[model samples]
Target: MKEFLTDPHQIERESMRIIQGHLQLDWTEQELKIVERCIHTSGDPSLEPVIRIHSQAIEAGLEALKRGALVITDVEMVRAGIAKKQLAQLGSTVECFLSDFQVAAQAAEWGITRSMAALRMNKERLKGAIVAIGNAPTALLEVLELAKDPQTRPALIVGIPVGFVGAKESKDLLWEEHQELPSITILGNRGGSPLAATCVNALIYLAVKREI
Candidate 1:
């Protein structure tokens, strides 16, 4: 699979092709316009063109899904009972689900940075300290699960955390849960958040770009 940073339009086009190839879905012109608007507003071409939703995020997600837009949403959105049933009814129409684990992971990474910053008593110095300590893998898994489609098999699973209660366990659970899938790529206990996020983002960028 090819991976590179590209413009939003390019990513959107490639994503459209990938979804069509994998799921046999087509985007209406209006749907494409919505995506373009989102991309334009976001102003980050590298940004994944996901229809994100919280509780209220579902309306937008549903609209996007109907229009052939790829969705990346949390479990709460489904649990809220807003559009979960309808979304599932789409039948292979929705492309991805970013579980709580994914959200927690991303949050944990930020928490770690924040914690380290507090410990150092300086936000500006945190990056250097984090770099000196190396990347944490446990943090990476959380974020990945958040961004990854639990339905689509993952190629790498990196678990990098220092010493947080339940952090390692969570990653372990993720690895165990998906162990049967050979597409998984897992990093050992030594992996760090920075590395994990970078790697995961790269993989996701490739996944969206290649339409995997």
Candidate 2:
């Protein structure tokens, strides 16, 4: 039998120590925090190289959180994984419409995935909000389309949908074509809800730290 670390804080500290030992980049403090959390969630330090953050993403995300911006996610898993209490403390909120009946109906009517429909339906709410997409390339693509209109543009885009389909292409388009948007993303089909959630949680933690 293996001896397991039962204390959560101790386990996290140990994990961070190991991750820091593996990190090679000279990332900024804010970038480092988000990268560390994403790596910690995925248990993959090698992912550091492919993780891309726009120059303005951290500051944009932080400022939005500071202003009590709404954090919208593509799916409930991402929303559920976020730090709800901490976000509430910062006067921010997280939401997911993936499972909503209206979203389902809209998806059916539009011949699209629920993720895309959810984003489309909530376009107005996206204004100045943080949009985190962790499960669907279609949703990320839809966001790009919605962003063409200033009224629906989000403050920061966390686009890390995992799949072999359009995931890589969607992210590539976001990183390359939408350089003007404040964003964070993995360059390949190597992301998930946990990674997305941890990224937001890291930002929330940083926001709280700034207040202390």
**Best prediction by TM-score:** 2
Candidate 1: how large is its RMSD?
Answer: 16.3
Assess candidate 2 and give its lDDT: 0.93
What is the lDDT for 93 in model 2? 89
Q: What lDDT tens digits, residue by residue, belong to model 1 across residues 32-134? A: 3333332333343332322211222223323333443332211222123223344344431221222423444544666753222222222221111111111
Local distance difference test scores for all models:
0.32, 0.93
166-187 in candidate 2: lDDT tens per residue? 9999999999999999999999
Question: TM-score of each candidate?
Answer: 0.24, 0.96
Candidate 2 residue runs with Cα over 4 Å from true position:
210-212
**How far is 57's C-alpha from truth in model 2 (Å)?**
0.3
